[model samples]
Target chain A: DARVTQTPRDKVTEMGQEVTMRCQPILGHNTVFWYRQTMKQGLELLAYFRNRAPLDDSGMPKDRFSAEMPDATLATLKIQPSEPRDSAVYFCASGLVSTGGSGELFFGEGSRLTVL
Target chain B: AQSVTQLDSHVSVSEGTPVLLRCNYSSSYSPSLFWYVQHPNKGLQLLLKYTSAATLVKGINGFEAEFKKSETSFHLTKPSAHMSDAAEYFCVVSADGGATNKLIFGTGTLLAVQP
Candidate 1:
């Protein structure tokens, strides 16, 4: 079974530290999404990429957060000078949109970040 | 723009009993709705989806949901509940016109199964 793989399943960092989370989307999938989950905000879409090109990153804080797909197999989310409020579980999902215009997303185990 | 609301923040059901998790959505045009379940320490898993074909969508783990356009609802249901069914369930809506699959998610409902 193919699955999206995420690195640093758990991360603990002091405030102001830089944190990087990595994801390896399923082979052959072209669409990748990054989402952050928090108890107060539920799940918020941070960014997404299609064919290794970022389609949107409006939900992410441009000042501190950055998302990039260096290549088709690797997608990364980085937070420079991370704050305490940045603590959340970040999930990466991959999917293939068909001609029908609909498809299901396969999610990674998620990287749990705890900023002190 | 589209949004989803999960009616209950928490739902408790005993094993062998029926299960119901209500969801409502609002969108300007026809929308694609989905149900996802997240277990503790696990990633979100797709339960089922309704993409304008069949109103009644069946999913894995004996769960299913029906799309009611008139009611703007796609509520998840199961005949019998099991202990393993305890998890956080999210209702999501996708934008119309197939531009992108970006989704708007609900706050989520926490299901508790009692033995």
Candidate 2:
């Protein structure tokens, strides 16, 4: 069965460390989304890419957070000088968006990040 | 701008009892709505979705939801609750009724199944 794959299921880093989370969307899916889950914020869409092109990143923190889709299979979310407040679970989801598609998303097990 | 409101933050039901989780949405136009369930330490799974099709949508795991345009509600329901059904349920709305549109999620409702 095809599924979205995420690296580093759990990560712990001290404040000011650079953190990177990677995702490999299911093959044949054309859209990838990054979402952050937190107790205070529920689920927030950090960014998304369609057809390997960045579609939106307005919800991401421009100073520290960056998302890129270098190719069709790989998507990355990076945080430079990560802070303690950034501790949360990040999820990557993939979907096949088409005229007759259901618009459903297949999510990867999230990457839990803790910045001390 | 589209948004969803989960009426309850928590709902507890005994096994074999009927379950109801209420949700209301606000949108300027016809919208696509969905229900997602997240188990502890797991990713969110799609339960069901409504895209202006039939008013009632049936989903996996014996779960279903009905979309009410006049009430602006899409409430999830299960005839009999099970212990395995304990999870966080979120109501989601597509900002623009498209796969590419951002999905606005409601604060989840934690469902507890008691024996």
Candidate 3:
């Protein structure tokens, strides 16, 4: 059974520190998505990549948050000078697009970030 | 803009009882809908999806949902509930006219199973 893998399943950082979360999508999936989950906001889409290229990242805060897909296997989401409000569970999901469009997204266990 | 709304913030059901989680959607075009469940401290898992093929879509774990176009609803249901069914459920709608397949998520419903 193939699954999406994530690094640093739990992270605790002081405010203003930089936090980096890594994801290894399923080997053959062509689409990758980054989402942030919070109690107040539910799940919010931060960024997504298709075929190793950034497709949509409008939901990401350009000033502090960034997502990159340096290669097909690795996708990363980084927050520089992270704030207390940035404390949330960040998830990475990947899927393959069939004739019917994108299929079910396989999500990682998520990196839980706690900024103090 | 496409949006999804889960009617109840929380639903409590006893074991062996029926389960119903209501969801409603708004979209300009024919849209794909999905139900995802997230257990405590875990990632979201896809339960089922409706992509315009069949109105009644069966999902894993003995759960299913029906798409009602006239009502703009895709409510999840199960004949019998189990203790393991407690989790947070999200209703999602796929964005229209995009090869990227962006999704709009609902606020989510927390299901509580009582023994």
Candidate 4:
């Protein structure tokens, strides 16, 4: 069975620390998405990739946040000097189609990180 | 721009009662609408989706949704509510016939089922 997998189900870090969250999307899925869930912002798209290439990342904070797919199986979100405002649940999701226009998203369990 | 709005912030119903979660969307182009449920500390699970295929769409766990293009609404419903149905529900929209795959999500509505 193929499922989107995420690491560090829970993480606690001090403010201004570097944080790296990783995800493994479902096998053979063409689209991968990164999202951040916060009480104030709800669920916000951080980045999106298709065929192992970044298609859009306008939702991310350019200076401090970066997302990359080093390989087909691994997608990483790096936050340098992560702020307390960045404390929230990060989710990695995959889909069958290239664009959400096709509809339906398969999501991972999510990686919860608390910035103290 | 595409966006979704969940009409209700919270709804509480007794078990075995009918369930309704309202959603409205705004998009420049025709959209593929969806309703997703998230259990505590879990990921969002697709409950149902509405494209051009049918006005009414049925999904897992007795959940269903209707796409009213004219009204720009896709509301989720269930025949009977269960305790396990308690969770956060999100209404999302994406351009079905457009170029991008990005999804715009609603703020979310919390549903509570009482035993």
Candidate 5:
């Protein structure tokens, strides 16, 4: 079955370290989204790409967070000098163009990051 | 800005009892609502969605949600609960395709089913 795949299921690093998360979206999906889930904020959209071009990243902290799609199949989110508050489960989900009323999604297993 | 609210923090039910999870949304445009379930240590799974076609939307594993615009509620209900139904449930809302399609998720509700 087609599924969004994410790498490094778990990661633990010291404060001020850099953390990178990777996602491989479904083969035919046209949209990719990155979301972060934490206890305080619940789940929030961090970034999104339509047709491999980033459309929005306003929810992301520009000072330390960056998101990019080098290729159609791969999207990456990077954090430089991560802080303890940056620790959370990051999820990647893919969907098609929302032309019609129905638009479903396929999600990755998520990367759990911990900044100590 | 669109937002969602999941009313219950946690709910407990028996194996064969009916299940209900409450969700409400606020949006400027015609809203599209979605329900997602997350198992322990697993990613979120789409259960169902209300995208203006039908008020009653059916989803995988016998889960269903009804969209009520008058009440501003999109509550999920199952005829009977299974042990595997125990998970965290999220409510989502979006407006249009451009950037509003980027969903706003509610604080999830944890469902626990006992034997």
Candidate 6:
């Protein structure tokens, strides 16, 4: 069974520290999405990439948050000078959209970040 | 733009009892609605989805959802609830129809199943 893999299942950082989360999508999937989940905000889509090119990052804070797919297999989300409010579970999901496939996303376990 | 609303913030059901989770959606075009369940310390898992083809869609773990365009709702239901069914349920809508499968998730409903 293929699954999306995420690194740093748990992270604890002091405020103003830089935090980086990584994801390895299913081998053949071409689309990857980053979402942040919080008790107050539920789930928010931060960014997404198609074919290693970013399609949208409007939901992310441009000043501190960055998302990139350095290659098809690796997608990363980094937060510089992270704040306390940035504590949340970050999920990475992968999907295949090219073959007229169902618009279903397979999600990784998620990276839990706690900023103090 | 597309959005989803989960009517209940939390729902409690007894084991072997019926389960109903309400969800309503608004979209410019015909929307794709979905139900996702997340267990504690786990990622969200797709329960079922309703595209245009069928009004009633069946999903894993004996869960199903019906799309009602007249009411703009896609509510999830199950005949019997199990203890393992306790989780956070999210209602999601495809934000851009089928272009990129971008999804807008509702503030989830937490389901508690009592034994």
Which candidate has the highest lDDT of all? 2
* TM of each candidate vs. truth: 0.96, 0.96, 0.96, 0.94, 0.93, 0.96
Residue-level lDDT of model 5, residues B28-82, one tens digit each, is 7778789999999999999988888789999999999999899889999999999
**Relative to the true structure, how large is the alpha-carbon lDDT of every model?**
0.92, 0.93, 0.92, 0.88, 0.89, 0.92
Candidate 4 has an lDDT of 0.88
Sort all candidates by lDDT, best to worst. Answer: 2, 6, 1, 3, 5, 4
- Indicate the docking level reached by candidate 1: medium
For candidate 6, lDDT tens digit of each residue in A1-116?
Answer: 98999999999999999999999999998889999998888788999999999999999999999999999999999999899999999999998785445577889999999999
- Which parts of model 1 have CA positions greater than 4 angstroms off? none
- Flag regions of model 4 displaced more than 4 Å: A98-101, B96-99
Clashes in each model (backbone N, CA, C under 3 Å)? 0, 0, 0, 2, 0, 0
**Candidate 3 on B1-115: residue-level lDDT in tens?**
8998889999999999999999999999888899999999999999999888889999999999999999999999999999999999999888863345677889999999999
DockQ-derived CAPRI band for the predicted complex in model 3: medium
lDDT of 5 at A4: 94
Please state the error at residue B46 of candidate 4 in Å. 0.7
Instruction: Name model 3 segments beyond 4 Å from true.
Output: none
User: Positional deviation of B45 in candidate 1, in angstroms?
Assistant: 0.2
What are the chain A TM-scores of the candidates, in order? 0.98, 0.98, 0.97, 0.93, 0.96, 0.98
lDDT of 3 by residue, A1-116 (tens): 99999999999999999999999999988999999999888898999998989989999999999999999999999999999999999999998866767456889999999999
Q: Over the stretch A1-116, how does candidate 4's per-residue lDDT look in tens digits?
A: 77899998999999989999999988887788999998889998999998889998999999999999998899999999898888999999988774335657889999999988
Which residue pairs clash within candidate 4?
A99-B101, A100-B101
- Strongest candidate by DockQ: 6
For candidate 1, give the lDDT of residue A86.
98
